[model samples]
Target: MMKLGFDGKVALVTGAGSGIGAAVSRQLAEEGAEVVVADLNGDAAQTVAAEIRSLGGQAQHIAVDVSDPDAVERLVQFVIDRCGALHLAVNNAGTDGVRKATADYPLDEWHKLLNVNLNGVFYCMKHEIAAMVQNGGGSIVNMSSILGCVGLPTASAYTAAKHGVVGLTKVAAIEYARMGVRINAVGPGWIETPLLLDHSDTVSTRRMVALQPMARRGTPQEVSALVCFLLSEQASFISGSYHLVDGAYTAH
Candidate 1:
């Protein structure tokens, strides 16, 4: 129930097609931000954007693969061209690579995973920061995973990529602090999202839930609450920090 104001702000959320990304997009729009919903799935993006519009909010949709640098450049330009200015962003586009041991991970999957999960964030920040600087100042929330802070069995590639995201976020935050851009990472644990459902079975999910102190899965809306705060004036003094919405999974 802690609604923050984002009136007149233009915000971009990558991977806005579903889950946390979609949740973030909707909340931002409801809070008075003109949201640009970007995702690899054009249909899903359109759907989310349309939902916001139906709810009496302003929104637009775009399809772009963040893993592609050239595409990312175009994405930023698109935002500027359509929105007139870019003041906020959430680099939430990412993939959960197959769970495999380091020694058994496939080379191609590793590269692909890194491309979207890690390099993609860098590419987004590179362009987003430039635009934000021109706009005077802005805030960004990068979606990292609980894996970013700790290791998980059979998840070498994902853990590595997420860890890289945390490091990248910190570096960019420091470099842009004086430029009026604040960057931070969010680490979510066992969120009930497509990424989780697609990769986890009943037994596996239950087992994971059992490990949580909350004894249940976190919702995408829960994660969005933190994301929206980070991109708002409420978190003006918060930057270069890694935040967790993990239900105390790491408490142990």
Candidate 2:
């Protein structure tokens, strides 16, 4: 509904093979952005890209591990070489799904979680910002979590990593504000993504919805709309901020 601007621009989206990442990539493609769908599952990424092309959208696909600095660098360069420029980037790759309560969680488990969710975001921003600087300016949206602001049982690693994402987003936003680049983050609450599938039929999602004043979990598309606006020039004044698209989950 915001009718954001992406006409002729190029976007790079990670974890875009499914769920919220897929939704974001589709939304941008629909808005005339030439999107590069990056995911750990190369086949899935290719599938999404093909679907976008079928829907009268411009899209490409690439396999990337956002946690690896070298992979991130190559991904950025691929976008520039193929798409001509990189005006938008969404750092959405992460993991921690096999969530165990802190008391039972292993240190190695925690390390793996942080490697993807926190360090991965940092790697993406480092390479993406470098490219954006060369192109004058651009927009970046980092995927955080409602747990980034609030705490929940059995989500210690995820919470820590997401909070790190917010902190990283803020720092980058401030450091680059004067350079025409806007960096921000989205803290999605109980969204309908693959990450929630394990908890879908369980008491967790329902409990999460109950906690939300809106009384429901949000959809991938719902979050995508907010992200689209942030990437648009319309939100030029909005930067360095973490927006909670939680349907008032944090309000209570």
Candidate of highest TM-score: 1
The TM-scores, one per candidate, come to 0.97, 0.96
Candidate 2 Cα errors over 4 Å, as ranges = 202-205
For residues 1-252, what per-residue lDDT tens digits would candidate 2 score against the true structure? 667879999999999999889999999999999999999999999999999999999999999988788988999999999999999999998885555778898888888889899999999999899899889999999999898899877789999999999999999999998888899999998888888876777666567777778777789999999898999999999999999989888988
Best by lDDT: 1
**Model 1 agreement with the true structure over 110-192: per-residue lDDT tens digits:** 99999999999999999999999999999999999999998887778889989999999999999999999999999999999
Task: Give the Cα error of residue 251 in candidate 1, in Å.
Answer: 0.4
- On a 0 to 1 TM-score scale, where does candidate 1 land against the true structure? 0.97
Model 2: residue 107 alpha-carbon error in angstroms: 1.2
Q: What TM-score quantifies how close candidate 2 is to the native fold?
A: 0.96
